[model samples]
Target: MTAATPPARVGPGRATWVWRRWGVALRFERRSVLVCGTLAAVVALLGVLALGTGSLRLSPAEVLSALFDPDADPRARLVVVTWRLPRLLFAVVCGAALAVSGAIFQSLTKNPLGSPDVIGFASGSYAGASVVMLLLGSADYLAVASGSLTGGTVTALLVYALAHRHGVRPFRLIIVGIAVGAFLSSLTSMLLLSVSPQQAMLVATWGAGSLNGLGFEQLRVAAVVLVVLLICAATVVRPLVQLEMGDDTAVALGVNARRARFAGTLVGVALTALVTAAVGPIAFVALAAPQIARRLTRGATTLRIAPAALTGAAVLVTADFIAQRVDLPVGVVTVCVGGVYLAWLLVRQYRGGRR
Candidate 1:
């Protein structure tokens, strides 16, 4: 085993911790931290913008005042506090959770296309939700959320059972998930087909994924879950970084490869399930946030959790703001935007590889 070494220099004025022991090497740079901080500040600024802009536009100054002063402008209070605030929090919290979850899956699978849905959670959530609307005639928010959780749990167990061959192979797990996701999606479609027009419309609207009508209660629950999942992420993140060097290298570095894989899988699925439960499977934030964060920070060798989470928060809040103005579901906007980004990402990756 090697002794704890001092911070090493990476770039000018950038300090890093580089450690090696038991034939394993690990390093961390201060740059990621700095980038994450900047991104967090930007996200906060965006939150203010979200609070300010709408049919009733308040300036950033007014937004801040309304936030702090209970007896501020009555209109600002009504809009900011009772109307827009909870949705903004939902966008930020859910977006960050999805981005972090996506990052975990992408790192786990070593595939850029790796998303929270890659584990079948989206389909499962939809399936559960659709069942609630169609079979049980329950369109209540809590009922839908409960159904989504149950479906996600079923999908997770099924995928694990199919994918486990001695241990969960990353590629195999992804393949199994895709296959099961397709099946679950079909189940949702069948339910949609069989239901009455009113029921179908309800399920369809929810499936389109809206941040509409989110409140303090939902945000409170999501916040607690996200906090716990984040702690789990922190404890297992080092192993994730190590695994990026390859499974053998990860093993040499004292990382439990199977355990890390399962942890990532668990976190990724749970995050997606919770978000889907809250807002109905929001499209593309999870898939794009990590990639955008990596680009913005220029950090290829690290997980970039903070930057990714911030980017997701920014993206979703901005989308929600746009949705508010247009009276469109936030999910629809994300899907449209995500479709373009996904195309661009594929093209860029292809060009880079050819180079």
Candidate 2:
């Protein structure tokens, strides 16, 4: 890790590192790199703790040895390699995905509260899941996953349609998203109400969310989707950094604001949708991760996605560890903690007169 670098200059002929597709170049800060490494290390430690602290406990060293040595105890391997590893992996990957999604929205809207959860994607996903699990009476994984993807895509399109007049304005987008999100949440509630008691209870339990019983197959699917989205996110980061200087400035500097918004929103929604489909809506990871990442790296002006992604992984992995011990759904733990952070942010905003 080294000292952070300043922002990159953008133009037709000059760049630090230019992408092939346009006159796009990326700026990197060493601090963001350091933050990612530090957060990754933190996540690794928490992962070890999560694996070792369960009922069939093992030492950290034992965990490592078991991971490496193929001839290690079958029971140890079964628990660590098979059962625990999938959930642990999902915790880190999905956490990063949610945080990155949050960062994209925060940049687009210039609002700390802007996130997929608040912006209707999560509610849309839950509404989708409710349709499958409650209305269609199907608890199959494919059914729920397909429902979430379709619902999230439709919701994104709906929000875009409602927000776009001359073009999509970030403020209007957020306002419309919140409104749509509320409506979807209500739809979910109505579905819950209309279901049989047993079905409702099952849906409510899933709504609280869990990583339990997540198989490697699910991880494989999520990993593939996340990788593609992350690549898209990387490409859009340059334009997004320009967008922070104001839409007109971004356009003047050769960044297409509409394309940036479209790319960012699409990637962001896909990421959150993947997580929601996998583990249900783990609340507030998206809303808080980017801001936390910004603070961690002291708010790098270069659109700070890496740090945001790292911070998200740490938060979710740590939250999962706590959730396991407390016998609560990971969603509950995240929501409780996120609720406190939200309250504090609101109070601070009120005091700062930003409202």
Candidate 3:
């Protein structure tokens, strides 16, 4: 009789608790949306500034007008539509692609340092481009892109194969990648040395990864490749999340781990190749973007791919802006900034371990 009386309906308090939990979730979602919105706005503003403040210096209104009405003043139209817009688009697309690729690699390897650029894909592409430029004497964009894709894919396969004892271990993959990267880099240096002075100079500037010469054609190619790869990435996102669990759990959950890994590696390699072709070996977008996104999201499984892509786009566009204004190489700016950030990340990891 006492037990029956004690079963006072869990009515108002339970409802209140449910409501509070929902409210907390809504609040968290709102905060994430706000942060992402702010980031998008900032990136848009920076893009506008970058377009406006170059040697031509078009105002925001003029830039907008020129972008919309291509038949406007030919010079202004050309500067905005033909020249600056393509570069801006290239920076954004390349950045997003690289960032997404990095996030995929990091997740697959379960290593913070895992990225296409860090693991020698970019360097391998560079070597491929160098060979095409020097030996074949071809500056054709398609040829360069093809060469980059081949080089990066081959390097990825080699790394994977070398690292496969039973399965791909993170440390072994990294070590193999570094060793291969060094060998490819030395080969590139030798090729550069063998070429004529003019070719060498051209290669040197390209190697520094400036967004100076990219036109609409290059932008179009990069966009197509990026879109396709991104679509594939989206399709695989759920499986990839499952794959992040142990292999046995993933298998139990109906994930084909080996196939998923292969698909992810291909996508990652393709992205790196596209970026390397568009802008020669711009480092750190892939490395930094995912890390930044994870920090911003702060989820237990915080590989925010879309956010990472956006961050990468913002970083590259901003970096390109600085590079153009300061007359420095985009690669140089990225490496310097990325190096500092990487050091800070290492320190943070160390401190976290102590705690």
Best by TM-score: 2
The runs of at least 3 residues in candidate 1 whose Cα sits more than 4 Å from the true structure, single-residue gaps closed, are 1-28, 137-143, 160-176, 351-355
Q: Write the per-residue lDDT of candidate 1 for residues 1-355, one digit (tens) a residue.
A: 8968788887656688778899888887766767777877877888898888777899999999899998899889989998889989999998998898888878877777777675676788778877876898786667877887788777877988998898667778778988999999887888788878887887788789898888898889889988998888877788998998888999998998878877776777777877887888887888888988887777764266778888888889888878877889999999999999889877987999899
Looking at candidate 1, the ten consecutive residues that score lowest on lDDT are 297-306
Candidate 3, residues 85-196, lDDT tens digits: the string is 8888888998898899898888887777788877887788898888888899898889998899899988898889888998888878877888888889998998888878
Better model by TM-score: candidate 2 vs candidate 3: 2
Clashes of each: 0, 0, 0
lDDT at 83 for candidate 2? 92
Stretches of candidate 2 exceeding 4 Å from the true structure: 1-28, 163-171
TM-score leaderboard ranking: 2, 3, 1
Rank by lDDT (best first): 2, 1, 3
Supply the global lDDT for candidate 3: 0.82
Error of 2 at 344 (Å): 1.0
**Which residue pairs in candidate 3 have backbone atoms (N, alpha carbon, C) closer than 3 angstroms, thus clashing?**
none
Clash pairs detected, candidate 1: none
Q: What TM-score quantifies how close candidate 3 is to the native fold?
A: 0.87
Candidate 3 residues lying further than 4 Å off, grouped into runs, are: 1-32, 69-74, 351-355
lDDT of 1 at 112: 77
